[model samples]
Target: MKTIGVVDTTFARFNMGSAVVDEIKQHVSARIKRVTVPGIKDLPVASKKLIEEEDCDLVIALGMPGSKDIDKVCAHEASTGLIQAQLMTNRHIIEVFVHENEAGSDKELAYLMEKRSREHALNAVKLLFKPEELVKQAGTGQRQGFEDVGSIGM
Candidate 1:
């Protein structure tokens, strides 16, 4: 059985880790491990630990950046660290970040968080189990939280 790790931040307004786990469970049978940190910057180490210590095949790193310049900068820094962790572990860490300002209202924000989390969870499943599914959709514009802008005539 494959192990999927989920690292999320407590600073996020939504419980994206639960959303991810729920979505993954619907598609495949895998041991899902969850780790919660205080902020986005902590995602890399937690994810690395999940992969190196917990024996996870893949990790989903979820975070929400507030609507501020510093928050955006922190999000970028976290993303860079996540990339480094992936390189160090030679494993995939699916980065799912939803900026707080992406939506205009609370309802929209919640929807984006849920949709993005679930969609990325499915992507993780496909990556581990059926990567060819993704190859078939290549070049077709696919969006997670919003409507997919279909492929252009190439």
Candidate 2:
């Protein structure tokens, strides 16, 4: 069985991490190992350790960046670190992020965060075992809230 590593933050509202874990479990039959950090900036190291030391087959890194300019910058830095970790470990990392400013109100943000995290968790499972499903959806507008841009000819 595959082992899934989940890395989440405590700073987000609405318990988005738990929503993500629940969604992942619905689609995958695997061992789930989770690590919770204090904030978004800490996700990279925890994810790296989960992959490098904990022997996980895949990783889901979930976080909610604040609505400030500095927060966005910090998220970018954390993402870069995640990329580096992926290269070092030769494994896939699904970095799921929901910005606080994406919604107009606290309630909306909470809903959006939960929805986005669950969607990305499903994406992570697909990436690990059924990547062809994702490729089939390219340019089809099958994703929620996204428009079909049409496929490009190679």
Candidate 3:
């Protein structure tokens, strides 16, 4: 059976990883192994362990970064580490992040996180089983949270 490893940080008030798992279950039947770390910095090690030890097919990492410059720097470091983990394991790691300042209000930020998390979960499922489903979104100016970036120039 296909397995997905979910890694999230507790620095944020929301349980975004749970939201991703719940959404994935709605459309796919895959085993989900979740591990919650203290902060974004801890996600990489936990993700590596989940794939190497737990035998997961893929990993989903979720975190909420604050507005400060230091927070962004830390988030960047954590994301780079996650990428390295993926390279080492030869598995996909969907890194989902929502900045606390992405939206103007708490409600908006929450909504963006929920929408992005659920969408990324669906993306993970598609990556595993129905890759064709993901093709439909290519180059489309449609996305959750902020406006879509669409296809950039070559």
Candidate number achieving the greatest TM-score relative to the actual structure: 1
**Which 10-residue span in candidate 2 carries the lowest summed lDDT?**
140-149
lDDT of 3 at 79: 95
User: What CA root-mean-square deviation does each model show from the true structure?
Assistant: 0.6, 2.2, 1.9
Sort order, lDDT high to low: 1, 3, 2
Give model 2's TM-score versus the native structure. Answer: 0.90
Clashes of each: 0, 0, 0
Off by over 4 Å in 1: none
TM-score of each: 0.98, 0.90, 0.93
lDDT of 2 by residue, 114-149 (tens): 877788788888888899999977766444212336
Candidate 3 local lDDT, 21-44, one digit each (tens): 899889988999999999999999
Q: Rate the local accuracy (lDDT) of all candidates.
A: 0.97, 0.84, 0.91
lDDT score at residue 117, model 3, on the 0-100 scale: 91
lDDT score, candidate 1, position 36: 99
**Ordered list by TM-score, greatest first:** 1, 3, 2
Once fitted onto the true fold, the runs of candidate 3 whose alpha carbons sit more than 4 angstroms away are: 147-154
List candidate 2 stretches off by more than 4 Å.
141-154
Clashing pairs in 1: none
Candidate 1 lDDT at 105 equals 95
Q: How many backbone clashes does candidate 1 have?
A: 0
